[model samples]
Target: MAASAPTLLSTTSRLRVSSAAAFRAATAPLLRGEASEWVVRGEATVQVLGRSVRVRLRKRLRMPATRMEEMRATDVSIERGDNATGVLTVASRVSFFSRSSLELVQMGALRVHAYYDAGANDPAVPAAERRARAGRLSSSSVRVGTVLLPNYELRAGYNELEEQIHFDQSLGV
Candidate 1:
């Protein structure tokens, strides 16, 4: 038993080191600003026309891996449970006679599938060619009601012109 204890301790120490190394290797591409894709699935209750409606949302989004990481960091600081602060934007149209309004009531949960494109970070490739390889790097889509709502695109990242971190989010149907 004494020998087994030391063996277990050494194995655990090696495991911890390997786990940290694996994490860094996995995230290195994102740290280098490679492209990433995300498919977000969630359920929520929304108020539309004074009636409460339940919805299952499946949203597909693509952007720079670094920006995605920043958005995730911002999400960690969310204070409200039901309502998200700028994390989600809802836009609905107003019909002639009746005024239509959509408000999010509660967010159930979110399941996100993230994919990183490591090839975009190839140093030998030209910058423009890298971008071409990561085609449609920034795009988003979500379904509203029975119709698929069109995307109003925006990106979050360091803005060279603004000289600061810029976050823009808007949704339109």
Candidate 2:
């Protein structure tokens, strides 16, 4: 009976240690948060010189950190245009509450230009003008709307240049 008691005690302690390690492993991801990568590619129709032109839009977004009710995407690039490409890099912060889970509020500002290859061949445009053209382009936007997780998102954004609203809803299985 005495030997059996010591063996039972050792087994119980081993089980406790294993359970604690399992608990830590299960909660680590939730506490530390996981980063997600998102890529969006689309085309936008723009009217140029009374003619419609299809411009390719590609955005690579990274959500590096997420908390209980907020998420931050520090690395975001939005590229627009087919000929004279303009790249806009932005950092966005989004917040939401439980009562208004449908309404996700987002604020974003242009961080820098990854590339703006416009008027590079024009000798009439000074070197300084070419470099400053991208610097002069600045925009900040605020958006609000419903964003269903992992599936659909709808939002209206008001920026320095324009107010645009878009929706993305997935259908079928």
Candidate 3:
């Protein structure tokens, strides 16, 4: 019997953390690299592979309840583990009260996987053998960024492209 082709699937994902302060700290490095005493506030994004994820960072320069926009952007970073590498999906998006012009809305998680070359491996791509997974970009979605936001966001529906975001973290998040 002739073999068939491999199948790919996509999903949606979202995360919200009330601790905007911590989120900002965790992502600050990528947003404003090598800057001492640099703070960020507002929306930004980070892209992995080719997918675009939305991010919103708002920090208070001072504890007192008075300040300007402070910082506004999305910062993204990726690490190549022993096995996989891809974009990290994290957010604090609030429905309704959330900013209207959001930079991006993460669609799903991005991960890395190993595939034996089809010609050298099995031609019948197993349907139940999903080694890894990743998220995709929808048309009209904004690109995530940090510090100085990118001039143009990632292309829409990027997840549909060949081998999108990559990752191999076992953190179980």
Q: Per-residue lDDT for 65-154 in model 1, tens only?
A: 542222212212222222343233223331111111111112222122233445567687689866665522333322221211232112
Choose the strongest candidate by TM-score: 1
Name the better of 1 and 3 by lDDT.
1
Root mean square deviation (Cα) for candidate 3? 22.6
For every candidate, C-alpha RMSD to the true structure in Å = 22.5, 26.1, 22.6
lDDT of 2 by residue, 14-128 (tens): 1112254554344334324454443435667999899999987454534233223322222333332232322122323333222211212232221111222345435787977
List runs of model 2 lying over 4 Å from the truth.
1-32, 69-173
lDDT-better candidate, 1 vs 2: 1
Q: Output the number of the lDDT-best candidate.
A: 1
- lDDT score of model 1? 0.33
The model with the greater TM-score, 1 or 3, is 1
TM-score of 2: 0.22
Better of 2 and 3 by TM-score: 2
Error of 3 at 87 (Å): 35
